[model samples]
Target: MTQRTPLHPVHLELGARMVDFGGWDMPLAYGSQIEEHHAVRRDAGMFDVSHMCVVDLHGAAVRDLLSRLLANDVGRLKVPGKALYSCMLREDGGVIDDLIAYFIEEGWFRLVVNAGTAVKDLEWIGRHAAQAGVKVAPRRDLAMIAVQGPNARARVVSQMPAVYQERVLALAPFFGVAGGELFVARTGYTGEDGFEVMLPAVQAPTFWLALKAAGVAPCGLGARDTLRLEAGMNLYGNDMDEGVGPLESGLGWTVVLDGERDFIGREALVEQKRRGGLRRLVGLVLEDRGVLRAHQRVLAGEAGEGEITSGGWSPTMERSIALARVPAGTGDRVQVDLRGRLVSARVVKPPFVRHGQVLVNV
Candidate 1:
């Protein structure tokens, strides 16, 4: 059976185009995907991200267990509500999932993981938690809403309770604050500044309505995908999956390989690093008059061949862009095989756009 979020009725009432995302029925777009995308980039827009899973951990062993489970070191998250992005890996170095870990307080931590991998992620954490005697509680009773854009923060702040408004505004980037039933985080997947608010599932509808009345456009998955792609953020399954490691997925920075942390996949990554000659993920700007799509073959001349992991038209740049896994020494230029015809492209760093500004040359 397909799952529906708390705000499903609201989405239906708004005439959003719905599709099955993973096992949940999610909105693909409210109307025009391009218009919704622009709303998020230029003004305030909100996304119903309640399908994402939130898990809270407790007990003295929580930190220790996380230290061994994730590729990134959680010891860095000392201050309360500080969050860190990390990847959980298999023993063989393959990425199991990417998640955000928040240090709520001593002996307590919160994690927000991708909806598609929640079940397996819980099972994986449970298996490890049992040994360490850590308590793992999934917060399925919560709903998440991501409000993003240049004006996103101000709009959300106005809707928040007066008592909590000041604290929410004082929250630094990558931090979260909990008050009553609300947990507002100064973090978002979109490159624009915003807040990701987690509240009781029952309150989601009213909150969604309030934000809509406040002039926040209701965006859906289609716009979300384009926005994150332009921001150079990686989608769990599309950019990196169980078959690939972080090093090759342009997520090497998220992995803490220094010292003797002894996390999962440490030895494998160490060995791979020593072996060298690893393929890398690179950003590509289409120079030819063709659209770039995933699974397209990329020709890097003598350097070798590669494949596009994620590709589409960048609305901000008004050009086609892609993230491709290419040979280590690939040059600045390459060719993408689009419909049997080789189309020229330029290799650049990720982040084709940010804060409504095009970062790359069109």
Candidate 2:
């Protein structure tokens, strides 16, 4: 049976067009996808991200266990409620999953991982936790909602309890705070200022309704995809997988190689760096009139060939944009083989838009 989130009934009531996403029944769109995308850029919008998995780790050895499991160092998270983005890798240096780790206190941490890879991630962490004497507990009773855009923070804060309102406003980017039954983080997937709130599953429907009443538009997966693509964020299955490492996937910054504290994929990454000549992930803007889509071949005349990992029409930019993997020395101009036609495209850095501003020329 296909899984459904706690807000499945709510989505159905709103007449959402539901689709199967990685084994979960999710809303593709409630109405116009373009409108929803614009609402996030111009105003405020919320997404039911309850499909994400939340796991809490507790034990005296929790920190030690994480030190060996993740590519990014968790030790840097000195302040409470601080979060770190990191990748879990296989022994061969292939990316297993990318996750966010929140440090609550010493010997206690929280991790939010991709829904599709939750089971495998749990098993992987469990195998290592047993030897380290750490306890891994999955928080299935919680629900997540991502409220994004410029007005998102103010709207969410208005719905918070009176006692927590001030604290929520004081939260800095990449930080979270837990009070009562709510954990609000100043983090988001879209390139906008917002909060990702985690609350009890039973409270999700009521909270969704409250946000809706507060004039926050309800956005679906379709808008979410377009927003993330415009933001230059990587999707797990599309951008990177067990076949690719972080270095080639435009995530080299997440890996820490300075110290002697070696992680699972350290050796392989070091060797790959020593060998050099790795393909790189880049942003592409279609100069010709056409839509870009994944699996399309990228043709760099002299540098070499590559493929588009994620591509689509950027609603914010009003243009087609994509994230492609190309040869390291690939120049600015390239051609995309779209449906047997060679169309010219410009290769630019990722992030076509951020904070409602167009970062790249259209």
Candidate 3:
């Protein structure tokens, strides 16, 4: 059976085109995907992200458990409500999953992981939690709603109680605050200022309705994908999987290797760095009038060949963009094998657009 989020019926009532996404029935688009994408860039839009899993870690050894589990160091998050983005790795240096961890207090931390990988991530975390004397609790009773874009914060604040409005609206980026049953975070997948609110599942419908009343457009997965891609954010199972490591996935910055605190896959990553000859992730922009799709072969001239891990028409840029894994020596120009016809493309850094502005030389 396909799983349904708490807002499934709401989506249907709003005329959303639903589709199976990673075993969950999710809305692909409510109306025009391009319009929804633009709404998030130009105004405010809200997405039902209730399918994502939230887990809480508790116990005296919670910090130690996280230090061993994630690539990024939790020690950096000294302030309460501070969040860190990191990837959990396998013993062989392969990525298990990328998640956001929030430090709530001394012995408590919250983690929001991908919906598709929630089960496996929990299993992996459970196995390690036992050894570290920590307890992992999945919070399935919570529903997440992400209100994103420049006007997103103001719109969300309009619904909040006046007493909490100041603190909630003043939240620092990548930080979260828990007020009663609601947990609001200043984080979003789209490259925009926003808030991801987590509240009781029963209250989701009411809160969602209130958001709509606040003039926030209802966006779907189609717009969400385009927005994240434009932000240079990686989607699990698309940009990376268990077969890829952080160093090659353009996520080396998330790994901490300075201290003696060794995490899983540290040895393998160290070896990979020393051995060299690694493929690297890069951004690509099509120069011609053609749409880009995943699995397209890229001819990197003297630097050998590569493959697109994730590719699509960027609605914000009004062109085709992609994330490709190429040989480290690949140059700024390459040819993409699109349906037996080779087309020239320009190699650039990721993040084709951010904060409603074009960042690359497209």
- How many clashing pairs in candidate 3? 0
User: What are the RMSDs of all candidates, in order?
Assistant: 0.8, 0.7, 0.8
Runs of candidate 2 with Cα error greater than 4 angstroms are none
Query: Across residues 1-362, which tens digit of lDDT does each residue of candidate 2 receive?
Result: 79999999999999999999878999999999999999999999999999989999999999988999999999889999999999999989999999999998899999999989999999999999999999999999999999999999999999988999999999999999999768999988899999999999999999999999999999999999999999998999899998999999999999998989879999999999999999999999999988999999999989999999999999887879999999979999999999999999999998889999999988
Q: Local error of candidate 2 at 14, Å?
A: 0.3
Alpha carbon lDDT of each predicted model: 0.94, 0.94, 0.94
Per-residue CA lDDT of model 3 for 174-219, tens digit only, reads 9999888789999999999999999999999888999998899999
Position 94, candidate 1: lDDT: 92
TM-score for all models, in order of appearance: 0.99, 0.99, 0.99
lDDT of 1 by residue, 71-179 (tens): 9999899999999999999999999899999999899999999999999999999999999999999999999999999999999999998999999999999999999
Off by over 4 Å in 1: none
**Which prediction has more favorable lDDT, 1 or 3?**
1
